[model samples]
Target: MLNNVAAVLLDGVHPFELGVVCEVFGLDRGDEGLPVYDFAVASAEGPTLGTHAGFTVSTPYGLDRLEAADLVVVPAGSTFATRDYPPELLASLRRVVDRGARVLSVCSGVFVLGAAGLLDGRRCAVHWQHADELARQYPRAVVEPDVLYVDADPVITSAGTAAGIDACLHIVRKEQGPEVANSIARRMVVPPHRDGGQAQYIERPLPRSRCDTVGEVLVWMERHLDEEVTVEQLAARAHMSPRTFARRFQQETGTTPYRWLLRQRVLLAQRLLEATDETMEVIADRAGFGNAAALRHQFVRSVGTTPQGYRRTFRGSQAA
Candidate 1:
């Protein structure tokens, strides 16, 4: 369990994501028997600074405070694709990390981690829109495109802004176990454990049908992720022809049925990979991958890393 926390703020800090760091680690949850961190909002500049939302936050410390911190968090900011990060900030980040402190980023803050050189030759995750730019910016860093987050041992990054909450929950689960994490989630009104490596699949707008077309089909498919679910079966369940069902599913969800199912299966596979000591073959069977080879192929294709690699990376990042 970490006792110290430091958050490095950028010029255009996204208020919500930064608030996540404040709420999760910076706040005192000790009344609930959870460990409370001595947290500080850190920057290279003054304690009083500006946010992207056109307001000022009263930070109490600077980057030097991170020297004694156990975890360093970077929240979302604007101008990630083109702007250069302050060199001093990057240097201080590297220095603290070199001393063995864990580093974390949410959303576009992955850009700052990349800029700090912490992502060199490391497997990482980021918001999808910025994944290409992160890869292009740091050629050596392996970017996981669709995951909620990726933990490359001492460095961790999350997807879009809200996914930061998921990443922080993962850290809590790692340090305090599933029960404590669940308690915190109940208090926060979010999922208890959304394994760090799960995909960030936002549900698309579906047709507002007078009939239960897409809704029924979605529920049926979720209940039967393991069973062989054919398009024909879905069509039959929806009482529509196979051709029409496929057409309507795509029109509603913006993706093919098979692709969405594969993503969900991949998410289940990642959870089993992280939470269980099961072998790849067993995890493959349970997660509907048929075999370890199939699981690896799809996992590497979708997450930019093998299942074992993802597990190792995330397990190696804790108390962050």
Candidate 2:
């Protein structure tokens, strides 16, 4: 029943967000025996619209086209965070859901759905950068900033730019099957399914050198991830008591010494997985995980996938 689709655009639509929707539903992949959707872009503003990228996109379809859509997509716009959505467009969204259809929003497009009141009590996934504002604007919506996407049943929301691919593929996987979704993902040269949430992608800035701090200890920790070192030993090296060293470490790095070390180990393991052809056991030992089983456990917990899976993703299964 998931056939017809429409990507609704506003005045300042971001082309990449619009492209993600079009790539998922608008392409005619009949040559590969894929299900082709009755897809088109509909403009809320007018027939012609300017893109955030300083380009123009035209669509003959309008809000009327959304009425018949089995799935409706709202792509983020330049001022979606502050701009007002057209009331008619919001009404059409509500009507589409009322008629038992599904709706999806990429990035700030969730704001449009919020305006429609569709996300009133629903769990929503939004980019971390906008999560605060989204929560502020739609206090009733449960904003999950860490996740890549959330399938709040009829309403799907995704985080950031590429996460839209994750949401689209998830819907395809749900409706058609894993094979269809995977095939489409392969054609797009993206993963059919990503392992972890956005937490794995967030930047972890390490403390840098200054006159006196945990900078040298951090440098030592980074160099000696393969070795086992105690907080007492680190404290002794820093010429401070264990309690003071622990506090200073936490203050400077924004995390406990144990957590910082574990994260560093995981990071090293990731780099080794991506660039080296070492076996899991070897990589684990080098990264201080001790064994493959431990590596797999910690890797999955930290990266949302096994070391082998992560390696396969970053460096294809077959060696070059």
Candidate 3:
């Protein structure tokens, strides 16, 4: 359904994020019988676009190609939170979206989509650094910070950098089939699917000035995800009172210590579910959730999908 795709390249675009869109959708592997895309990179005003590295990229097509695309990709651009988006490009993006085609955004591109008003009522995901800015700009958008990507019906948004691959693969899986997506991923030499969301990569809070202490504490938490870790225990490692620790910890990291620990535990559960043949109850226990029901509740709350269902849908069909 989405064989025709377009990637909108804005000025100050990061090369790798633009390359991710090209890697996933612009490759022509005709021998594999994959659905080759009608892919082209277009500028906002038919001019040579500048990248973050101070280089210019010339494009053949302009904003008009986006109107004909079944799927439009907005790749990451630098300083999107600080930059001004062209009104004409914004209008063209809105017009295509109004016609019912899907719009996919990578990293800070969510800011551009938000500027265009397409992300008004939708749930969105962005680079962790820009999450607060996006929330500030579009208070109406349900901002998801726990996941690498958020698929809100037709408009899909991904967090920074490598998450763009996952987002694009999700689109391929949804439009064509799991089989085709797996093929593309294999050709790309990455995992056919990533197991968890952005939980594992989230930075934790530590009050201490010593960097090694924080690392030791985090290692302990990750290894013992199956057990309850009170703030007091973590505080003992840092040798600080609970009250002072909580306050300073918040300053060191953007999130609370408890929330960071809980998300990692959930991601651990995700790995076992996706890669192992273990039962849900056993996986739940290993992930610190006492029962399958608890695991299901948390998994759905954070990931928008069930454990068994996610595994079945993205489990290693490439192995087959």
Candidate 4:
């Protein structure tokens, strides 16, 4: 039923985010018996817009194009979080939702929706880096920081970058069917449905310490991931009492020793799955999970997907 689609743009729009919307909606797939949307790029500011990447985009379509769209997408921009949107554009967005049409936002584009008051009392997803700011800016909106996307019916919000693709395909699947979405995904060379949240992609850096007391023990732990060891043993290796070692480890690494080891083991398993053709049993043994079941359990907990699924995703048909 989502036959008409429009992407509204502003100055300083991020090209990749805009491209995601266009690629999903603008392309003609009628040759494969897929639904091809009546898609157009509308300019909110003017006919000519400057991209964040130093390129210019010119479109003949204006805000009037949105009047007939079944879905309106707001792609991310460099200054969308802080900059004010056109009053007319915001009003047009409210009208679109009022008429029962869906509106989706990619990354910081949620800020524009927030400004339009569409996010009030609605759950939304944004990039983790901007989560706090979004919550502070729109106190009424529920900001889901760790999710890849949130579908609140008329208003859908996605996290940064490739998450937008997931959201777009989700809309297609919901309206048309999995067959259509899967076919489109096949052409795009992306997973039909990715199994993970933003938590796995978030970077957690270790805090710098003036004097790293547990540095030597940390190195030893990395090299001996296959060997089972205890916190008491690691404390002894560091020449400190267990309590002091745990405290220092937390201060230096921002996480407990057990958690650090678990994460590293999962990362090692990921490498082996991606770059090697080893069997699950061998990978589990090398990563210190001891067995395939244990490896699967911990891998799913850490990576948000099964080891086999991850392997199939990364290695494709060559993962045998």
Candidate 5:
């Protein structure tokens, strides 16, 4: 049902974000039995728009092209966070959603959605750098700062660059099937699905210290994900008191030790689920979850999907 797609652009649009939308929805993948969208690039400012990369893009399509789209994408721009959108473009977006079509924003493009009044009372995801500003600008919108994407139906929002790919594939997976989304991902040479959120990508400013004591512990922790180690034990390994170690870990990593361990374990489980045909119990033990039930609980909490479901989706795509 999601056949027609259009990317509406403004001046100073980030080429990568525009390319993300184009790559996902503009290509004719029907050769591989994948759905082919009737795609176009629409210019909100004019027929010719300059990108932040010091190049110009000319499109035959304009805002009028959006009327036929089942999905309209607003790709990120350099000044989108502060720029004013054309009233006509914003009105078109509102009408598109009003008529049951979906609209999606990649990174800073979300600010445009906020301008269109589409984000009111909806949970949205944006690049972490823009999350606070977006929340301040659109006080009614719930800004999730650390997620890859948020699907508030009809108005999906994604975090920076690569997150747009995830959101686009998610839309494909939701509308078409895992097979189609996976096939597209295979062609793209990206993962069909990624575990976890943007928290890991955020740059935490560690304290200016003479030694990176926590970094050493992180390396050890990564290597021994299957090992059960208490914070007290890890603190001992770091040659610091448990309280000091905990504080240092939080300061350096922006998360507590338990959360960091849990996230790492979940990531390990995801990789295992995708790559190995191991039983749930085996994976649970290997990922330090101890049992399938624990793995399922933590996996569901972190990845938002059951291990079995994740495996099925992953393997299904690989099979395709």
Candidate 6:
């Protein structure tokens, strides 16, 4: 089992990402009958290192602490994408992996594993903002830009800030079972597992040119996900031809109307599954799928797992 854990820190590390590791592994959750890891924070820079938020974190443990850890986590640093990692740190990471232990990275920390050559010929996940740079820097590594995380077994890499929580919980679920992971997530007040990929979150994050051409139509579509409306109907609502409305919708939303609506429906179904004890048929109707069978097909297609399987993983078998 994963009894020992270590978080290897470098200067300019993001505190929230580091906190994700500490919260999931370092805390004494024995009261909840969960495993209490033998956890430590090791500094690669020195006894004290500065953070990107204009603060400093001091730790007595050093690289030697990583030797006994079953899992080593590298949280993101502000400059990790461009900065060179210490040879000693890279060597320690490779040593742990060589010993059959695992190494996980949060966000830009994936660059450290890339530098250690661990990611060579492996598929990895990174924050969408840095995905291009990661690919440009490590040509041999396959970078997946839009997934919450990738489990390449010995090396797990995750996307942005919140994705770190998903990765850590995933590790718990994989090693300790769904019950422990779900209990911890309940205490943390976050979902035990998230559905869909980061692709859903990345669509049209930036604001369009203030013209608000299709803003009203987009809002209407969001409120009426259950309705089977065509582009012609949406065009009538927007007072434009079907062709012009479709083109403008694509330009403004960075996705087609049908695709966007489908993604939204999937997202809604995920929330209902996590937060409520709803039946599949009910959830399907509420999320625009019409029936359990249709919901199951679309849910598995979009989330890589069946509805019941996902509910069981996140909510435990009794709840499922």
- Each model's TM-score? 0.68, 0.64, 0.65, 0.64, 0.68, 0.67
What global local distance difference test value does model 4 have?
Answer: 0.88
Candidate 6: worst-modelled 10 consecutive residues by lDDT: 194-203
Q: Write the per-residue lDDT of candidate 4 for residues 123-168, one digit (tens) a residue.
A: 9999989999999999999999988898898999999998999899
Q: After superposition, how far is residue 307 of candidate 6 from its true place, in Å?
A: 15
Residues 106-217, candidate 6: write the lDDT tens digits.
9999999999999999999999899999999999999999788998889999998988998999888777765688789998998766532444254455446445478888
Output the worst ten-in-a-row residue range by lDDT, candidate 3. 198-207
Tally clashes: model 3.
Answer: 0
Residue range 92-181, candidate 5, lDDT tens digits:
999999999999999999999999999999999999899899999999999999888998999999999988998999898767665677
Q: Candidate 1, residues 1-320: lDDT per residue as tens digits?
A: 46788888867788899888888887778898877889888866577767888998776677788888888898988776678877888998898789887888999898888889899999999888888988998999999998888878689889997789988887776655555666677888876655566557645444577385676887677667777788998998898999988877876655678987887788678677677778889888887889999999999997678888877755654411
Clashes of each: 0, 0, 0, 0, 0, 0
| Per-residue lDDT over 192-224 for candidate 3, one digit per residue giving the tens place of the 0 to 100 score | 655325442534433355653454666688788
Question: Candidate 1: where are CA atoms >4 Å away?
Answer: 205-320
Q: Predict model 6's lDDT versus the native.
A: 0.88
Task: State candidate 1's TM-score.
Answer: 0.68
Candidate 4 colliding pairs: none
Candidate 4 deviation (Cα RMSD):
9.7
Name every residue pair that clashes in candidate 3.
none
TM-score of predicted structure 3: 0.65
Position 265, candidate 6: lDDT: 90
How big is the positional error of residue 278 in model 6, measured in Å on the Cα after superposition?
21
